[model samples]
Target: MSQSQKKIHYAWVVLIGLIVMVGAAKGGIMTTGGLFLTSITEDLGIGMGSLTLYFSIASIVTMISLPIAGKLIAKYNIRMLLVVAVILEAGSFAMFGFMNSVWGWYLFAIPMAMGSVIVTQLAGPVLINNWFKKHRGLAMGIMVAAGGLLGAFLQPAAGNLIASEGWRNTYFILGLGVMAVVIPVVLLTIRMTPQQKGLQPYGMDEVKHNETIQVEKTANSGVTVAIAKKSSAFYFLIIFFLFDTSIAAFNQHVAPYAVGLGYDIKFAGNAMGSWSVGVVIGALFFGFLSDKIGVKNTAISAMFTGLVPVGILIIEPENPVMFVIATGLYGFVVASLGTLGPLLTTALFGNKEFSRIYGLAIMGLAVAGIVAIPTYGYMFEITGSYTNVLYAIFIMLIMNVGAILLAFKGKKKLEKAGLWN
Candidate 1:
């Protein structure tokens, strides 16, 4: 076949491989962490507040490492960087089986956070930006949906494993499993971009001739972090992400909260599993909706839906079914943030310095991790209930809605200034 008529582009294949690698690595750890929290606390005879402090430390490490990771991704080949990332992430997880003291978690959390930053947070968006010029939002949505799908399956499986094998073995098995799956996949299929394979993005051919000509002229005109930072839209976008993520921190404590309310571990796990199911559905739906209704509207709708679960938790639902329904609704909003967050950024600011800008923006998420989870734990430690945390989440939800509205208003200012096309 002639060069232009070659059969396979290979970049799409790489994209699929990344989806699986990221999904398994992230789902196996993040979604499963809460399931193990109760078991580990019981076995180790540690307070939940203290055990949760390890997560806070991890978030602090992640914040410190992000700028360095950003520099590495820009400077190095993606394959080597991802390989190191998976090893750090999975290896740290497996080593958790050996920890008998809180200090062990504090130390291991550093590497785990480092690996997670690369594989879970940075890899997907950077790869999607490199691979697909058109339908980029759809691609990002699918990637995040892949992670939720894995979580939907793996979370329940993790709960079952914890029930059967104990938490230590559970962590060992999952960590090793993620490593076994991700290592070969990254080495075999992950690539930096379509250009590295000498092929164009999959949909480039469908552009109208006039649009095709414009691609070359504007290829270098993508937005940079410097320009993005100068806009008010960027600041409001950060605020939007911060509040959205603070609400999501509730997932880290959902099982514990249920168990604290007199439910069995199995029931708590099943409740969390239901929440994951909502995540799967919401990710796919809101991802598509963001494309149609616009990012600002989609974000506002998500934050608005966040109020449902807080209401249920605060009202202290007597019926188990009501509790499950309310938490499931919250899960849907949380998943929408996963799909919409990056897309909103891309919409507000083009993909010029996408990695750097996104890196900076997700620092808010890291900060939320630092504050929200441990604060929930500490609130429970002090009051013996999650009521205060729920109230705080409700307030953050309201503020998030206002923040997103301000983002759109800010975007108009940027547009008028010729900052965004």
Candidate 2:
């Protein structure tokens, strides 16, 4: 094919791979698995605390796996890695069907967490950074939004399957489905770098002909992983990730919060679905906005917008319409995890050592999973209300805006010292 005929960039193919693979891993497995929680506990006659501890175990594993996953991604074939990742993740999920004891979950949580770190957490950001130089934010947003869109349907479907076929069959079906769909997509579309396809990343026409020049240019604009690890910018990003994850953990408590307010379980599910809608819209909006107004500004706007939902939850929790709106708005802001997080990293440090740096930064997410969820639950247990937790989230939201500003300031210092080069 001539150049004109071959004009469809392969970065988009990689993007499609990312969307399908990550979305399936997240929607098919991670997001919808909660539907099986009550069923599994009830069927197996396990305590809720005992059964749920497996998720905690998975979080700890995820924390330890992030940096190791990053190094492996840098060294291995992207296609092969993702294929193995999906099998481990989805396969273990399928295995959950056969176990009569809670110990099975604890044992399988190891591989589950490992596989998930690669497919769900690492792949989308790393691959997008590799494949798209321009419109990177938009690409990240689309990937995240695709998960939201998929989960919007998948959650309901999983719920119905659990209701009709029992949790065991539903577990097997979801695991098999994810592996069937995601592995093939990874094989077909994913590549470690544009060079493998003899092309440049999207929006890299000016540097298309020279790989050496491309590397040099990008390296000069960013700090190395070593320098970034020692810098305040890095610490600030970690703090931001922590607060972001902690704040968003409130989503898990939303159903309970609603039930506390006298809403039925069905309404809670519907309300959570509304939140998914916000996720889709916000992902796209923040991505496009980051491209237009820049990452820093877009982040500040998100933090400000986040306050609205928290306020609604605090002051008007009983108003069903407002509750849905607030939850949706909160999900919209949560889109930042998929959108702003990576983009901000790139903006602050460039793409020179992006995978390594991002891998380290996201440890905060894993840590939050361990700390935040239990903290929220504990606070509610002690206080008999989410009022304190909501107030704390409000303060964290404000702190997030400050962290963004401080991180940018740290970036300026790095640039001034010529450490970026």
Candidate No. with top lDDT: 2
Question: Candidate 2: which stretches are off by over 4 Å?
Answer: 1-6, 38-50, 99-102, 206-216
Residue ranges of candidate 1 with Cα displaced over 4 Å: 1-11, 217-222
TM-score of 2: 0.91
| Count of backbone collisions in candidate 1 | 1
What C-alpha lDDT do the candidate models reach, one value each? 0.81, 0.85
Q: Tens digit of lDDT per residue, candidate 2, span 110-214? A: 899999999999988988888888788899999998877777777667766777788899899999999999998899989988999898778777344668676
lDDT of 2 at 161: 75
Candidate 1 structure quality by residue, lDDT tens digits, 1-421: 3565466557568778877887898678877788888888989998888998888888898888888888898899888888899889999998999999978888999999999998988878877777777666667677777777787788778888899998889899999999899888888898887878787776676567888888866644546788778777778888877788888888889889888888877777777777877777787778777778877787788888888878988895557998888777777789877688888777777666777888888788888888878888989999998888889999999998888778778778877877654
